[model samples]
Target: MKKKKQEEKEGEEEGRKSMILLSERQMKEIYERAATIGAKEALKFFEAERKKEYKGRADKRLGNTKLLLRNYHMLKDHAEKSVFGRTQMEESALDILESMMSMYDNEVIIESIKRSATRTAVIVSHIETMLGLYEAYCDKSRSREIERRRYEALWDMYIAASTMSPKEIADKQHVSKDTVYADLRIAIEKITALIFGVDGLTVR
Candidate 1:
């Protein structure tokens, strides 16, 4: 058993040495290949998470829509009541309508902004809202801008992940396949920036 262990250790040492002696190009190729696999896995995880989030959002939106429609019908019926009753009903209807409109506007804005934004921005914004930043920020425009920056950060992450796929990233980054791996380090820095909000990328 000891002899076998010794042989295994030697083999491992030889392998390490060979790896350590690899040319820069060879090492980069290996790193890129490994990064490609890691990026694909990360993307799959992200996509699954997004799907779950979308389903929850969709269900909530549907329920709100139903509630809005019910309120609308109730308000319409009350519109034929006595003056005081009509006024009260009208007020209630307006409240519900306002709530519905606010939700509608938010959805529209999210959709429009997301189209041009990065995934990082969307994720960060969603996280911030979930954390009750809306209450703290109290300004819709400012909140949306924060979300936009988050999206840009996410885009940068995506770009970095793409760089792992050397062949595709080579052309995209306008660099040779041999040099594309360098971008991975740059990407890591960008991701760190996004996470840390070092460049005022995060909303306060």
Candidate 2:
């Protein structure tokens, strides 16, 4: 009986490995297909929205950055409902999966979903799990531009202060130490505004 149980466990593990390999392969192919469809339509919409939003402010750098971020969200929503497929989970299950992002990063959530996919029989498994994984992957890749902004200000400050004392940073930037400190403060504020929007900090 002990030998039989061990053999059963080994068979299950091998089966899981096979399933994982096959599912991962399929996901890559489907992702490429989704990307092809997403690129053309997303670009067209983004361009139109950019021109519309920046009609008279072509030189407004911060305004342009905000508009691009907003347009990206629109693009992502369109893609989610279109090429990337839909969630098959219950509303509660879906909410739990999304909430997982707070505790686990995208890469962790995606791999967990992929591994989870191996448990169900091929014909009976829920496609929602795999779709969620793919959507997470797609969002991560598509948001690369927005993610870049998350570090923009910090990077600038780092560049200014990397090899210099705070005093030197002020001298190099043509400002007093107080102003250098202010510059660093403003850099953080800019990153926060870009990420979270300016409305919260705005005074009516």
Measured by TM-score, the strongest candidate is: 1
lDDT of 1 by residue, 50-106 (tens): 877655554444444333222332332333342332323322322332333345454
Each model's TM-score? 0.30, 0.23
Cα lDDT tens digits, model 2, 92-157, are 323433333344344453333333322211211222233334334434766654333323323444
Tell me the whole-model lDDT of each prediction, alpha carbons only. Answer: 0.43, 0.43
Which segments of model 2 are wrong by more than 4 Å? 1-156, 159-164, 199-204
Instruction: Show how many residue pairs clash in every candidate, following the order shown.
Output: 4, 0
**Model 2 accuracy (lDDT, Cα):** 0.43
